[model samples]
Target: MANILEIKNLTKIYKEAQNEICVLKDVSFSVEQGKFIVFIGPSGSGKTTLLNLIAMLDKTTSGSIIFKDKDLTKIDENLAAKTRLLDMGFVFQFDALLPEFTVLENILMPAIIANKKAKTYAKYLLEKFGISHLANKFPPSLSGGEKQRAALARALINKPTILLADEPTGNLDTQRKEQIFKDFAQTAKEEGTTILMVTHDIHAANYADKCYKIEGGKVE
Candidate 1:
């Protein structure tokens, strides 16, 4: 498969009033198209920062994030936002579902933002994830696992080419976590979606096509 995303000599640094904190240093890797990639690390590791840089949510100190041959580090904020909405899906540590909206409405948020008719697709995703019965329920009324599942469905509603997940299964139990891992693996296999996930859970390595360990600001 072709390389869907490439991280070449990536570095990220933060300044805290005369103190310099380098979270990532000279990291490099590539994600193949339709492959499930997992990064594991402890807290304060650069794993989350790595995802942020790829998602263009944060600026890179120096490096080239080559996505489809374009340098993400060099893109303007407007283009970055558009790329994120149109080509990438994200599931953060928290579900981040809107409390005021019904489950179905929340799942349709991205489609609404993109102005695409995806209601039917959203329904299909809900059913696929076994959450069709909860479509009319609100986030506040759902359990942690249910909320997480809804968040996953929402992320996929746009059918993004790449899914960036940060500890996405933290809210679920072992069984649910494994189910989600299987779902991610299947998504990559059947739909050609490239998945880049960061988690503290070592079990995720079992489901990933490629796995990396990040520690002390470097990836191995």
Candidate 2:
């Protein structure tokens, strides 16, 4: 498989009270197309920060992030935003679903924003993730697992080339977490979507094709 994402000598720092706190230092990695890669670490280990940088939600202090052959570090805000919409899908620890929208509506939100055709794909994902029955229901009415599944469906609405997940199973029970991981693995295998996930659970990381542990701002 070809490289879908690459990070080289990445570093991030936050200044507070005349002191610099380093979040990431000289970190590097590459993700291949159609592969599942997980970053495992303890709390405050910069996993989320790394994901944010890769998703273009946050800027890096220094270094390069290449996605689909483009150096994201050199892109302007407008181009970065466009790239994110065109090539990236993100699922957070929180479902981030709109309370006012039904499950189906939430799933289609990305497509609506991009003015893309997605009804058929949305319905298929909803059914595939076993959330079809809750299509008309609101987010508040669903369980954590159901909400995450809906969020996953929404993420895929754009059919992005890369999916970035931050602790996707953090809020689910063990059984539900296992089921979701299985679904995610199957989806990656069948659709050839590149996935980079941040997880703390060893069992969850086991589902990934490759795993890296982050500590003290470096991959171990």
Whole-model lDDT, model 2: 0.90
Candidate 2, residues 81-194, lDDT tens digits: the string is: 887887889999999999999999999998998989899999999999999999999999999999999999998889899999999999899999998888788878988889
lDDT of 1 at 64: 95
Q: Which tens-of-lDDT digit does each residue in 1-220 have in candidate 1?
A: 7998999999999989999999999999988999999999999998888999999989999989999889999999999999999899999889999999999999999999999999999999898888999999999999887888899889988999999999999878999899889989988998799999999999999999999999999998
State each model's CA lDDT, in order.
0.92, 0.90
Global local distance difference test of model 1: 0.92
TM-score of 1: 0.97
Give the range of the ten consecutive residues with the poorest summed lDDT in model 2. 199-208
**Stretches of model 2 off by over 4 angstroms after superposition:** none
For each predicted model, how many residue pairs clash, with residues at least 3 apart or on different chains? 0, 0
- TM-score for each candidate, following the candidate numbering: 0.97, 0.97
